[model samples]
Target: MDATAPPPLPTRGPAGSPRGGQDDAAQLQLLSVLHYVMAGFTALFSLFPVIYLVLGIAVLSGAMPVDSSTASSPGEVQLMGWVFTGLGTVFFLAMLATAGLVGYAGRCLAREQRHTLCMVAAGVCCMFMPLGTILGVFTLVTLTRTSVRQRFAHGAALPPSTH
Candidate 1:
């Protein structure tokens, strides 16, 4: 090959080959799976606060017994109930929204479209900790790579093979 010739384009290899576009596709696949798992957890966990609020309201309304010493005045109890209800609703809604955004980003990443939007969504996921942190870091690293960016920008002529 001529010294000045550019490197040959990489071919899709057998599963687990360490090639440029293949690596980017694998990373995108991983990100999609992570986002899906996170979305399920977010939807499931969001219900917990709602359940707690309902139980608390029942206790405050005298449908459930409370320790006499720990009980507050009826007015105070009502106020606390209202506050918890509002906060729990906000938290539940926020979690659902985050889940939706992450899921959408995953779809975009898989299709190799809206690259910048996917990066921003991944950055937001980083704030969530644990799984989100892992996914976000991997996403940022993979998507920022020149080869990956080019793949996303120009669109892949063929979908990466799973096997």
Candidate 2:
């Protein structure tokens, strides 16, 4: 090569196509789509039991109109409705509590800003069924394994201790 020759520009792979950039963009798009889908699923999943409970209450109270026009014959339906409402209430409370625990774990995880409150909020939200348990478990796992939580807890990175 001539001493005066210009250096070669970095070429894109395979016919000058920017494969890495394209791959990154594709991954971002895929992840965005997944996030949306998961958000929708979580909203629906968390609210379903509550909805069932409310509906059950309405049904039992004769506020919801069923197929039966006879008011006196709402015995079996009322019983079932009450049962469903009771179960739903129990589950809703449980989900809420679980969410709270997970949130605590989250606060314990952040390094710079130790958002114990945020973690508490997260745990509170987790009280709701699949959301609380699933998210809580994930946050808990992340906090337990990483030095982030430990550092945050101590307000500084911990130095290795010699025995």
Candidate 3:
């Protein structure tokens, strides 16, 4: 043996080549819970743009003017209202759909099924920044592990409610 050779990797915990089923199960459970949490937060944040919708409606109805001093013409106000409404509606729908997909991925992760959907959801989640990014990265890493993949492939994981 070389005198300066690095020590061998420990055969334990996640560092081990084949972490036992229990660790894999625990990790999947944790990831599932985090996915649900991120989904809830995403859904909650999705409501913020609703204020834009409300304001747009008010402007369209003439209750709110685009410019208080009337510098802008009615046509401009109408156009702005439509723009706001359209932007708000699109954002709300997109965010809500992402939240639903993430939640379903969490459910699938818990049950060890629909691995492709979970991977896709995790990839989508990477775009949310901060908390979602962290959760998504961790989920992607966990799901790609050999032992974890085996568990998912074999349908050995049970939902938290069942386990």
User: What is candidate 1's lDDT per residue for 42-106, written digit by digit as tens?
Assistant: 77877877976786677667776656666567676666667777777788888888888888888
Badly placed stretches (over 4 Å) of model 2 are 1-45, 69-73, 111-163
lDDT of 2 by residue, 109-150 (tens): 322235354345444445546744555444444434334344
The candidate, 1 or 2, that scores higher on lDDT is: 1
Greater-lDDT candidate between 2 and 3: 3
lDDT of 3 by residue, 1-163 (tens): 9989999987566533354777777888888998999899999999998999888888899888456576456688888889889898999999999999999999898888988899999999999998888888998998898877877777875635733
TM-score of each: 0.73, 0.43, 0.83
Q: After best superposition, candidate 3 residue 117: deviation in angstroms?
A: 0.8
Q: Quick one: how many clashes does candidate 1 have? A: 0
Q: In model 1, where is the ten-residue run with the lowest total lDDT?
A: 12-21
The C-alpha RMSD in Å for every predicted model, in order, reads 6.4, 12.3, 4.6
Top candidate on TM-score is 3
lDDT of each: 0.78, 0.52, 0.85
lDDT score, candidate 3, position 98? 95
- Model 3: lDDT to the true structure: 0.85
As for TM-score, the candidate ahead, 1 or 2, is: 1
